[model samples]
Target: MKRFLSLALCASMLVASASAVSAKTYKMKIHSTGNERNQSTPPLRQFAKTVEEKTNGDVKVTIHFNGVLGGDRQATEGMQLGTIECGITTTSTLGTFDPRFNVFDLPFLFKDYETAYKAMDGELGDMLEKACLDQGLRILAWGVNGFRSISNSRKPIDVPADLGGLKIRCMENQLHVSTFKALGANPTPMSFSELYTALSQGTVDGQDNPPILTFSAKFYEVQKYYSLTRHVFSVAPLVMSENFFQRLPKEYQDVVLAAGKQYEADVRAATENLEAETIAELEKTSMKVNSINDENHKLFVEATAPIYEEAEKLVGKDIVDVARSCLNN
Candidate 1:
């Protein structure tokens, strides 16, 4: 018995030593369209720092901000093809890869940050992450794109009717288009890169985005009204190429995954903190900001309620049911 125990201990030590000695150095890039001043950028930088420190320099991480590599879709495709190591992309972009992600595009699915986090960190996120893995992408952590609001040059949107006849630039997603149509706005699906020019030239009357984006992207420079619609809550996930993630040593994989969770916490906190500050900054600019009152908020909610049925069909009843359950809890 003593000899058997001694052999087991020896084997464990040998394996641990071998793992330490055989650690491989890996260099990886994390791509994001957000620039240096974007609210999520600093947390992402810290995420890279933590990854490098935890791995004892065995893993080197470099971040390419401002879409140096490509837009969200391009970067996502690159990762899926194993040409890009990692990236952070909106669920809308991921929706194209897997239609289940379109669930996020549903209007008013999340009414607040806490509810949003609970759903994404719970079964809704787990199921979506698993579905994405089957498509060659692995979701490390789900983060926020903040709740989207409408900003138009025309007027303050106190109610659904206020958006009537406005040409709102929306993401190239069917649900978004359908939602805008329901709200009585003309949903012009356009590339984000052309938004500034379009808004400047009045090609589109306005656009809906998170307040931080309206400030960071300087959309306020062209538009006059900013309403706290908080219409749709968007999520961005830090994703890695499944192939690259699998290629890592188990210990390094653990480090990277932990770093991803840290990134989620850091970025989410940063977003929550920056939101009020971003709004204050917007208020200081030429933009007029307003919030939808409880009565008006209800009106907005009721206006888009029909989208839920469409959402169920688009992403399956189970996903929509689970997401609604998360919010109710």
Candidate 2:
């Protein structure tokens, strides 16, 4: 009887040790709406790999790409609810949570990639991240999506007047709608999942997006012209649930945040270099690529100026001032 009791105690101790090991292992789900080959995908994959390596595989990240789980907005909602751990989505999509995100949608806000990067990596970025935290989401890093340009089946858009009467599909952001309206296009906010069908069925005459997006999504198949408007420099945000992040061990948290910064660098490099290549590829598909001259671009700038004012009211004048200073500096 003494021997049997000792054996039973040993078995119980082994089970407890196994349970403790299991508790230390964490698996996180990350969702993205882009394809596997997208510019954002490489960095995201790298982030996962780095985190696993840094943590010695204590933390694992599983990515769901091409909207497998749901669209961007839905994925964000999932993150907030703690149903999903992380997501990489556009600022426009995230505007649904905080209208302050719409500030990025202000037309011609970013002069070039360099200026935009400085703003995102500096104080303005910190402010935006804090705003997300207040809403129960942690902003891991700012990911790049490149500059947004117009693509259409009807005609080339070189200036604000050319966009007149064009029905353009935009993300569900108030600033996007206002900017498109200012540019003379009839803006219709639609979900990204339904945009392809809407464009193919002539429900929308045009849409604006980055070259990588147009090529990867095959928007060139239905579109005839690609205009280099570079109206809005877009940013993709890597976000995690604040609740989930707080629950992580300090060492695991450090691994994840460091990985996020590295991923941002990879994403920016990939997105910037791929634009010219992707545009060249799209041209081979019979899409006429048009570059807007500086004179005409000034007209577009003027038309969308009111959008900045509206956004200032929503975010704050100080934030807008800082962004403007970034542009000037």
Candidate 3:
């Protein structure tokens, strides 16, 4: 009887050990190139908080901001290699991994935030998410870095004509280069990490980004003119490494997706609010800010009309048509 009791106690202890091991906690490291103050950070931070709270501390997430973990491109590569678990990056750079994403970078595609959100949340978003999965990244939600605006150290760019002879810095996307080439400016594709220094040191004459980045990143101090070109709305996706995501419990996976989708509105609102306030503050500064009316805007569009054709060739006509369908409806 004593021997049987001892064996039973030993088995019970082993079972308890196994149970404790099975209940082990998970930790996630999320990365982004955006600064701590960048509009993109808050939504992700909110997601982390929601995930931690709902999971009862079963999961813990740490965020690396301000390119400390390398820029968006590097972080994405790290995610693919399992060196990192999560990342939020502009979809423009993602085309380097999946060509189909190039369609999203088409200039003048989205008229406003409403139009952009509608298209992204619809079938177009579904298509892009599938493509991301094929590239080994599972998209959690579609987010934003806002529309791009031109800021140059030279004259005000009220029209494409003003861009002549100016060496404009663009994202490392070929289509952006083609668009700028068509407009008569010299387009230089450089990594975002090097942009500010390039501008300050006069390596590039001007660059384009949202108003918030121009103000927050202190590009206004380096560049003299800010134009309301509103050329393209850069879409950012919160993505998890496919391998890492597959290893997650089903309940935790659902929490991640739910938290990601729910917090998108909060990010968008903060970004929009920042734009107006940023523009107001920038107006008080020495930078000369300008916006084109209907005519000049039309001129800018007409100049870049060939971009649609190039986009059709890059991602195929069908994908472009699908995106247009969403925009139209």
In model 1, the runs with Cα more than 4 Å from the true position are 1-23
Model 2 ranges off by over 4 Å? 1-23
Computed on alpha carbons, the lDDT of every model, listed in order, comes to 0.91, 0.88, 0.86
Best model number under TM-score = 3
Candidate 1's C-alpha lDDT?
A: 0.91
lDDT of 2 by residue, 94-165 (tens): 777887777788788888899899889888888889889998999888998899999999999988999999
Candidate 3 residue pairs in clash (backbone atoms < 3 Å): none
Across 191-307, the per-residue lDDT of candidate 1 in tens digits comes to 998999999999999999998888989999999999999989979999999999998889889999999999899999989888889999999999999998999998988999898
Weakest ten-residue segment in model 1 by summed lDDT: 320-329
Cα error, residue 317 of model 2, in Å, equals 2.4
Sorting all predicted structures by lDDT, with the top scorer first, yields 1, 2, 3
Clashing residue pairs, backbone N/CA/C < 3 A, model 1? none
Candidate 2 local accuracy as lDDT? 0.88
TM-score of each: 0.92, 0.91, 0.94
The CA-based lDDT of model 3 is what?
0.86
List residue ranges in candidate 3 displaced over 4 A: 2-7, 14-18, 326-329
